[model samples]
Target: MKILVCISKTPDTTAKIAFADNNTKFAADGVQWIINPYDEWYALVRAIELKEADPSTVIHLVTVGGADCDPIIRKALALGGDEAIRVNADSHDSFYIALQIADIAKKGSYDLVFTGKETIDYNGSSVGGMVAELLEMPYVSLATKFTLIGSEAEIVREIEGGEETDKVALPLVVSCQKGMAEQRIPNMKGIMGARSKPLNVVEPVAADTLTSIASFDLPPAKASVKLVSPDTPEELVRLLHEEAKVI
Candidate 1:
């Protein structure tokens, strides 16, 4: 099976986020970049596990970004992806990224496409579904388990109360989350091998972006906690209603 894993470069969770251009652009001055956790731990790792099980399976990593994202893609390749594809484009919009991925998948004739449920930066879970719509293939979101049997696929997805399992045919897209597979660390040999692996660069097709960022703003500071006496219960209620707006 030929599987394409969509990877994203995101800032480390602990990085200090700031804005430039009068709050219109993210400041990348001292940020540390890493692979989005959901993509690395679940989606990409599951594909690598599938490859380990079946030697014929091939895994390729794809990312929509400029040359600065090459390091992130290389890390994914070291984890077990056979090769990498970097789409030369600005990934400011989710639809533009998905369109590029759909074009690559069509040209490569891949049977399966995998993506993380959401990126940590934006938390918008829209790319995989958009790619599926563009490719006209079956799509499963928030998949926690996946099994391939001949030409059919068995998938388990998280629902409201519990889990739901379904079976579908090939040429499928799935957005994965936790419970799919355990994360793997790249060893010395794998890291060395990744240096020589093929890294293909492709130009993005002409497509119009639907949205643009207006500005960036940080959340308001938290208020200090207040201490209330147990004897004045009515005062607490009044404070909740007027000050906290809880009632």
Candidate 2:
């Protein structure tokens, strides 16, 4: 079995976020980047688990970004991917990135594709569906559990009020979520082996970006909490009716 896992670099959670170029671009100075958590913890880890269950299974990691994304890719390799591919392009548009990944998936003839439910920075949950559409494959999103049985895959995904189960054939795409797999930390051996792993860089195919950032605005500051005395129930009621306005 061959699997393609899509990963991306994102700002560390603790990194300060700011905008530049008249609020049209992200400020990257002094910011630290890491593998997007959902990709690393759920999507990639689940692929690694599948590879572990079957040694013949080949796992390949792919990312669409410039050379600066290498470190994040290397870290993902350290977690257990057989090889990595980097698409040399820089764009925030989800369709553009999905196009590059779909191109690679076509050339590789992978049996399965995996991606995180969404990126932490943008929180855009569109890439996986776009890739599936571009490849004309079955897509299952927000998958919390995935099991492979022969050429078929059994998946459990979260829905509005409950979970839904699906069984799809090979050459399908899944967007993984929290319960998919446990996070794995790179050990010394894995880290050492990752240094020798092949990281192939490829140029992106021709695709027009359909989206652009207009501007970014920070959320308004939170209001201070108001304390209500337990003895003054009438005052609390008045406050809730007049200021809080919930009642």
Give me candidate 1's TM-score against the actual structure: 0.92
Please name the candidate that would achieve the greatest TM-score relative to the true structure.
2
Candidate 1, residue 200: how far the Cα is off, in Å: 0.6
- Report the lDDT of model 1 for residue 89: 92
- The TM-scores, one per candidate, come to 0.92, 0.95
User: lDDT score, residue 92, model 2?
Assistant: 91
> Per-residue lDDT tens digits of candidate 2, residues 23-44?
8889999999999999999999
RMSD of 2: 1.6
**CA lDDT, every prediction?**
0.93, 0.95
Q: Model 2 lDDT vs. the true structure?
A: 0.95
Error of 2 at 242 (Å): 4.2
Candidate 2 residue pairs that clash: none
Ten consecutive residues with minimal summed lDDT in candidate 1?
Answer: 219-228
